[model samples]
Each structure stands twice: as C-alpha cells, then as structure tokens.
Target: MQSTNLKFIFDHSAAAPGHQHDARVFSESLLCQRLEDGWRPLPQGVLLGDSGYAMRDFLQTPIPNPQTPAENRYNAAHKRTRSRIECAIGQLKNSWRCLSKLRVKDPAYAAEIIKAVIVLHNRRMDQNPEDLPAPEEEQEDQCPPEEMGTTEARAAGKQKQNELINFFVR
Candidate 1:
C-alpha cells in the first residue's frame, strides 16, 4: 500500500431493522459478530475504536499481533486517527434526523436507509476529508475493562486491560 493511503475504522451497531437498539452490546462479540471477517493487518494500517470496540476479541482478534507494547502504541495512534470516524458518525446523525430517530416502520426500509447512509458517508469522504473533524474526550469512564467472559478469555482480557491501564497510569 502507498503511504498516501489512509485507513478508517468505524463502529457498527447490528440492530435488527425495526428493533430497538441497545448501545451497550451493539458491537459486542456475541452481538455484532464481525471477528470472523477477513481483516489482515498491514504495516501502514490504523484502527479507529470506540468504547464498544474496546474488547480484546474485537481489536486483537482481527488485527495481527494486537497484544503487545508496540501494538498498543499503534492502536493508540490509530484511535486518534480514527476519531474522525466518530465525528463523521456524529455529524451524520445530526444532519440526518432519520438516523437518530425511532427505527423505520418497515424493517427492510430501515436497513436500506442505514446502508444508504453509510454509502453516502463514504462518498462524501472521497470528495473531501476535511468535512469531518476528529473527536475529543474530556474524561475517562470507570469500567474494569476487557469485558468479563470465559475463563481463558477472562484471563487474557483482564491481563491485557491491566497492562493498558498501567501504561496510561504511568
């Protein structure tokens, strides 16, 4: 890939067309289910993440070697770079009342609208990247991190989360 190429990582919420959306589990592993997708990492890659995408399985599972100090540095940078996606989401939601409103009466129509919006976002970006600004965080939340689940999974997730917390603390 060329150095000029930029990467984008946006969060996805899998709310059934007409169903009410649950923000907490929108992108959770059991709920969102995108880990199995084909996503191979590249040296020049960047990943944008949100509170929902802040899981070991979600970030580490998809990208190669996502559990290391070097990986952590890369992910932090990616997080900053990807902040633009969050802003894009915010802007789109603000601009399109339908996006943030109650789901469309027709599930299929709602799904179609959501897809169309995503496509429009991409097209708009292609036209100009300056339209969306990056997001800024004022404070932190008090979550233990690495959502608790599975024995082996818990160990790994807890260990990684602890490492990150310690890193930032220092």
Candidate 2:
C-alpha cells in the first residue's frame, strides 16, 4: 500500500484461502480497523486504491463509468498516482528473484520473508535511491470485486471524488 508521502507502507502476505481481496485485507488491517475512538481518520490524506477497494472518505477510486470530462481527468490522475505503488511492487519483485515464488511451504515463514524484503527494499532505496531501476511497463491486473462501504461513507467518498474532479478540470 502507498503512504501519504507516496512511499510503500507495507506488503502483507496470506495463504491462498486467506488471500482475500485488497479491500478486505485493508479494512481488517490494524491501522484501518476500529481505533480507540472509532475508525481511524485519514487526516494525512486520501489513499488511491484500485476499483477492488470500496470508495470511502479516506480512500478514493475512479468512477466505473465517467460521464464528464472532469470525471475523466480525475480518473487519469488517480491512475497515475496509484501507479507509483504498483511500480514499487514491481521493483520489489525484480530486485528479489526469490520473491517471484516462495518455495517455502509455511505461509507464516513466507510472510516473514516478505517483511524482510520490504525492509531491505526501503533500506536500499534510502542508501542509494538512484540505484533502483525504473519500473517496467506492465499489463494492468484485473479489477477485484468492489467492496461496498457504509452508505454514509460512500456518499462522503463520492463528494470527495467530485471535488477532486472539479479541481483537476480547473
């Protein structure tokens, strides 16, 4: 996932059965789950997620069928922003050949390995940011099923998306 500073936050791993859609995993994540007061407020900024995740105040997604030029522009910008995270993912895979396929049978062990890779990726980038190779062109992955959020949250999200569209159009 991408952080507010447009950096990869963490990469989670799960077994085949537990490998649910991104939205499900995100919603159930410690950061996103219930907090001391309630759902964590996205004070930093909205996250750019693919269509698989539900639109919410903290998470913005493109309209399925953009009807206006403004909507189209918003989608374009949204995709560009989301691509950064995708590129990061690709870089991780490229840097660590072993990550392509974990031969380890234990899912827990595999997760540990992934965590280690994330740390190494960050460390390498920090030490020599220019050393990392550019992300290669890649085919878009199929959109995961949409995960609907609360009615109120959906409405709020739509409003936020519209605001962004207007900003982009201007």
Candidate 3:
C-alpha cells in the first residue's frame, strides 16, 4: 500500500508466484487477515481498492453501474485517487531497475530483495524530497464491475458507498 504522497505504507513482502491474481495475493496477506479480524489500520479513513477486492466498510471500490451523475462522479474520483498507487509503483520500478525484471529463483530471496528495494526507495525519497513527481493527468477509466459475491461486509460497504455518493452530490 502507498500513501497519497506516493510513499510506501504497507508491503506484503511474501512473494506470491507471478501467476496468482492480485486479489488472491491480497486475500492471503496478513493485512487482509487482520482486517477480517477487525483491525482498523487507520483511525478515521478508508482505503480505496479495485473491483478485484472484496468490498468492506473501510475498503471502498468503484460503483459497477453508476446511473446517477453523483455516482459517476464518485467513480471518477475513486479512479483518480487509486491511480496514485500505480504511479508510485512506476516510480519505484524506474528508480530501481532491478525491480523491473527480478530474476531471483527463490521466492524467499525475491521477497527479501523487494523489501530491500522498498526501504532504499523510501530512503531515496527522503534524501531527495524535491524529487516528487507531478501528479499524472486524470485519464478516463472504465470502472470494472465488483466481483465479490454478496456478503455482510459487502452490505455494509454498499451503505457507506451510498453515503459517499450523497456527499459528492451535495
């Protein structure tokens, strides 16, 4: 996970095989397990996730079919905010060329390498505070449909999403 300033917040260093879907990797993460056990990593904010993730009150995703303008606006804003992580990853890869094509044969070794890169990347950012990149232009995105089936968590997330849509409308 990354902050709004493109700084890494949480990185599940356990390397999953590249073939695994991101959602699956996320599901198997300690963060996800903690979230399931009612751990609120942040006190007063929610995290934005893509459609591949299961909806939760603290993990918001885009509306699959936004009929109202407010809902559409919400989706647009969600996409813009979520794209920060993508930019951060791009920045990380650009800075550490080794990350672009990690050829480590051992997953454990690869995970260690990734963790080291993240630490070094953060250090570089700290040293070169002025190296922050300009925000990328917002590009139109087709919000993917939510994939997780109905559940109690999804119900609560839907309610929270409605509240956000209303807030945006006003």
> Which candidate achieves the best TM-score against the true structure?
3
- Residue 84, candidate 1: alpha-carbon lDDT: 48
The pairs that clash in candidate 2 are none
Measured against the true structure, the TM-scores of the candidates, in listed sequence, are 0.51, 0.81, 0.85
Q: How close is candidate 3 to the true structure, as a TM-score?
A: 0.85
lDDT of 3 by residue, 1-170 (tens): 78777778654645886666556677678887777677886755777877766777878888877999999999999988888777777778777889868987888898889888888888888899467555444443334444554488788878888888998898
lDDT of 2 by residue, 14-116 (tens): 4333446666766666655542125555564777777777787677887789998888888888888877777877777778778877778777787778788
Candidate 1 has a TM-score of 0.51
Model 1: ten consecutive residues of lowest lDDT: 1-10
Residue pairs with clashing backbones, model 3: none
Model 3, global lDDT: 0.76
Expressed as tens digits, the lDDT of each residue in 58-123 for candidate 1 is 333212346666556745755565544445556556545677774557766776677677667666
**70 Cα displacement, candidate 3 (Å):** 1.2
